[model samples]
Target: MEYLPNIIFAVALIVGIGFFARNVKKLSRNIKLGKDVDVSDNKSQRWKNMAKIALGQTKMVVRPIAGIMHVIVYVGFIIINIEVLEIILDGLLGTHRLFSPLGPVYNFLIGSFEILALLVIVAVVVFWIRRNIIRIQRFIKPEMKGWPKTDGNMILYIEFVLMLLFLTMNATDFQLQRIGAEHYVQAGSFPVSQFIVPLFDGLSESSLIFVERTAWWLHILGILAFLNYLYYSKHLHILLAFPNTYYGKIKPQGQFNNLESVTKEVKLMMDPDADPYAAPVEDDAAEPEKFGASDVMDLNWVQLLNAYTCTECGRCTSECPANQTGKKLSPRKIMMDTRDRLEEVGKIMDANKGEFVPDGKQLLGDYISHEELWACTTCNACVEACPVSIDPLSIIVEMRRYLVMEQSAAPTELNNMMSNIENNGAPWPYNQMDRLNWVNE
Candidate 1:
């Protein structure tokens, strides 16, 4: 009967971690549904990018207020969770303060954790106020309505509760240790939670133990729950940011990827001695059977990774010139739409036993619109603004490629320019000989 708590803890841990693993597997499968591309070049640069952007969060501080608050919450939450290791050990072995043997080191670690926990609570409160009360324009955008808004607020609440539970557990433990309660050892300092100790001053030893155990169990369970919740939330970036930044676009932003087949055709057209009807050589690097991306499957795996890694922070949209000028092209919405469609496709595949059934729906014209796609000036501001290296512009360009190449749906102005370029070798409706006439005029 004494081991029942340990058994229960073991069961809960297994279930929580097992569920999280399953979700991760599903996320991996969904991301892999997209086409593959070679991101093998620049290993050194990629590592540096991951380290600088994801680990160091260099881009996040572009706006000081939110970035500083985020760093506080981020650092504090991660550091405080180190105590979870101790909790897990204690739960499994039926020991209290399992690391108490470390003496002063343990006390110092606990003191630091207490301080961080308090900081995390304060940061979370500030985040809540910014989102709910202050109503930051980026946070209040159309894409952030409904579940997105609620999810954002809910995450803050979870962090708030978790920190409170940590302090409560620590305070009760401190009180119990002062009274020399059975199984409570003299260990660890609680700089922040020390103030919380007075609340338990009058409680009996048994009651104090009950409160501490309850808080401890709830805090650990909450962490587990938060872990699993990440799959459903935009917070998947918390895990995927490292890899996303590593595989992020390294080429110059203005340089678009040209179609291999189109490039070959253009080269042949310029060759004087090349046979017009010669059979093409079979090579490994071939253009896709279809031009451009009309759906999630048409995108490269990295772009899909970008979609999943979106923080929904709206920095991209806030920076986009098109969005700034009141166009329908919100870069944040572009990523959100891609992710939503990808999720829809994943669910469809899941329902049909691992094969995607034709759902008569696609990312283009359905989730995202023609107006939004056309509004983009290909300026790449969204790319620059993404803190985690998500390039929403890539998705926009791919969809635009599909619209132009597959459907011949390029705007009339673009069509006319393409025609002029083909016939006159310029984006003007003038003969080559007459092109220089503009100088005289």
Candidate 2:
């Protein structure tokens, strides 16, 4: 019975990690549902891009105020978690500050963690103010109304609570150690928590121990719960941003990828020497199942990765020309819709024992409207603004391709232009003989 606490901690760790791993497997499966496109061409350049954008936060700094605040939270949250390793060991072995043998080094590290914890709290508070009181335009967009707004605030609250618990745990431990309480070691420098230690000045030794123990347990368990929460929140970008930036689109922004089958048909049409009545010689390679993305399955894996990696910070939408012009297409919403559809598809696969059963819904018309797709100007502003290099434009173009090729439902003006191209070899209705008539006259 003495070992029961350790056993419980072990089970909780295993269960949290196991459930997260299962979700990761499901995430990978969903991403791979799309067609494969090779993004392995550039190694060094991809590395450089990832380092600059993901690690350096290059794009995020374009707006200094929010960027600085975000950097504080991101850096503080990451660095403070270093102490969690020691916490894990102490929990499992039932030791008090197990790294105390490292003595001064451990003290310095704990001191640094505490300082960062304070900074994280400050940053989180600023973020809350920005979202609520200051009311940033991007945060208050139509698409951010319901769950998205709640999720943004929820993460900040989680960070605030976790930081408070850490300081409380440290403060109580400091008081307990001063009284030479049993198993309360003289360890961990408390730069910020020292001020709070005075709050427990009048408490009895047993009550102090209760406070410390409760804070310690809650801090660790809260971290574990937060780890699991990433799957549901936009905070998953904290992990995916590196990979997303590394595999970001390498080609020119305006250069659209042509379908290979369509290219071959075009080549055949242009070849005058080719036999018109010859028997067709088939290639061994299998043809693509779909031309363009009507659903998530038709998109490439990189596009799916882009969808999942979205920070939902609205930077893309804020910079989008269509959105600026009051159009219905928010690039942020496109990524959100794609991710929502992918998640729905994943849930259906789970319910059916790992095989997907269609539910009469598609990403194009169901989650994202045709009007939204048509509103895009293909201006690449959203792509340029994404801090993590999530290419919402690529998904937009693929859906547009599906609308044009599969559905033949292009806007009337677009249809007219395409018809002009087919008949007169340009986007004008004049005959070829009349091409130079205006010049001569």
Candidate 3:
């Protein structure tokens, strides 16, 4: 029964990791539901983008106040969690302070972890205040009303609690070491937690050990739970940001993707020698091609990746011209709607055993309204504002494509412009021969 604790630790570890892996598989499947596109060009540029944006966080620093605080939380949390390796090793082997053999190096590492843990706690508190108390306009947007608000606060609460548990565990360990308790070693420094050690005074060695064990168990378990919770939270960016930035759009921002079929027809029209009614080859007689995306499946895989990678920080929306002008088009909401619809489709597929069944719902006119879509001016401001390189504008343009080509339901002004362009070779109601009349007037 001495090894029973190790066995239970192993089981918990396996279960946590197992559930996380299952969620990853589901995420990948949903992303792959979109049509494939080649992103293999510019290998060096892609790597540079991933390194600069994802690893270096260059874009995040564009806003100074929030950016610095975010960096502190991000860096401190990551560095503090380095001690999790030590925790896992100790738990598995039933050894206390297994790395203490490293002498002063272990002490230095512990001291650093303690400092970072404190900093992380401070940063988390600031973040909570920014969301709830300060009531940032971006945070209080309509799309952030329900679950999004709750998820944001819940994450902050989790981080705050996890950091507290870390310090509590260290404080109890410090006390146990002072008492020369069994299995406790006089190793590692605790700069911040030393203050916490005073609270453990007058307690028996047995009580100290119990407190230490409880804090230790809770800390590791909480980390595992946070890891698994990423599947449901916008914090999925924690894992996907690297890949999303790597495969992000590399072309010029204003340059749009043209439909190959439409380009082909236009080219033929300009070819003077080409027969207008040429007999079609067997391959050319195939069914007509789809014009644009009416649903998530019609979008490219990279766009789908963009949806899953959205941090929902609302930087995109905050920078959007239309949104700033009180338009219904919130760029953040576009990405959120896409992700929600994709998840809904994925659940339907799961219920049907791997095949997607039509649920009489689609991304357009359902989760995302035409009013919101038409409000966009295609200014690319949102694309530029995304720290992780998410391109919400691409999805908007594609849906607009579906509206114009598939349904011929473009706004009246747009239809009139197209009509004038087709008849007069210009976007005005005048004959091509009378183009010089403008100068005469």
Candidate 4:
């Protein structure tokens, strides 16, 4: 019995550390591949954001059921570590009963943990049903139809099983202690386990011992394996989410990256360069690069990383009015396209062992389409919906800015709108002085 605790602890520690190290390396590689981003600019804002999003879970609460359930499970997981520690101590140290101090307080802790465990199990089961059986529209994709559906479901199931195992193990232990043994009544609470005591009344001493040993091993091993499995799956978010949330963008969603000014020698040849207010170009001899994304390679590292980080939660696509109205634009598709293009180009680049460029065609014209770019209202619904803080609207706006400023190619309506804004201070074709014409004077 004493050897069992040592074995579980040794195996769990080694496996946990090995898995953690391997995942850390993979995460480091992913971070290195990301584009240079400035997330440390506003110290106060970052702290405030962390407090709200991480501690308070402000954004998650928008979906009450899911949010509340997740919050409960998250808190439960953190607090239950103490219980796990106690279990380990009892198994290895021959303590049999743990947390026997502060009679009422200990009982309360046990009771609360038991209730939370039950709740977590229930919540996880509902989550699985929601993702698989209920098949929520927001969770599915047409392209995902043929893919294996077990990854998400499996994680949820593992969590459910772990919680159930914990409860069962604790209940059996509590029953044994109540039968004249020094029960580790750490608190005054134990409602569920107390009720469970009746079931063990008819069992013989040998049967009770077998049940205790089995439940302990199952609960501990199940939890340890689940922890290790987290690194290799989407459940990586369990560790990655905190850092990702802390490093999120602090700027307004609509702002685009500012382009740098050209050199003096090149600036003289262009007429706009001679004017102080005019936009700068690279050089007099340098040909103008086409505006907007030409291909997947043109995306910055952060944009490329965004593709990998997407959980396929479909919040972006669901919030997109274009997708809702039956248009070709799905923000989710845009993300997937970026990922696919990167993989395609990466393959060619690796095969040739050199930088590879696609044959002449532009990404917008060939892959994304001019209509799709024009369809965006810049409403920023996708920006708000993203759980990982990927800013699709910023990408769209940057591309739109490139089209208008560099290519001078925009939709007919946009062209007219720009002309009106340039000459009359508004997109409407009305006199600037008469802007308040509708007001009763």
- lDDT per residue for candidate 2 within 1-441, as digits (tens), equals 998888988888888888889878888998888788988899999999999999999988888988888888888877877789888988889788988888899899999999989998999999999999999999999989899999999999999999999999999999988899989889889999999988888999999989998998999999989888888988899999999999997778888888886788779888999898877666624564466789998888989888899879999999998898899999999999999999999899989998999999989889999899999888999999999998898888888888998889899999999999999998988898788888879
The CA lDDT of each predicted structure is: 0.92, 0.90, 0.92, 0.68
- List, residue by residue over 325-394, the lDDT tens digit for candidate 4: 8777777767655555555565465566545656565455655666777788778899788776666765
Each prediction's number of clashing residue pairs: 0, 0, 0, 8
Off by over 4 Å in 4: 1-5, 88-98, 143-148, 180-188, 198-201, 260-310, 332-375, 395-441
**Highest-TM-score candidate:** 3
TM-score of each: 0.95, 0.95, 0.96, 0.72
Report how far residue 216 has shifted in candidate 2, in Å.
0.9
Task: State the lDDT at 354 in candidate 1.
Answer: 97
lDDT of 4: 0.68
Q: Candidate 1 clash total?
A: 0
Sort by TM-score, best first: what order?
3, 1, 2, 4
Q: What digit string (tens of lDDT, one per residue) describes model 1 on residues 1-441?
A: 989999999999999999999999999999999898999999999999999999898999998988988888878867876789999999999999899999999999999999988988888899999899999899999889999999999999998999999999999999999999988999999999999899888999999999999999999999999999999999888899999999999999988888775787679799999997777667624754788899999998999999999989999999999999889889999999999999999999999999999999999989999999999988989999999999998889889889988899999999999999989899988779886787889
Give every collision pair in model 2.
none
TM-score for candidate 3, residues paired by index: 0.96
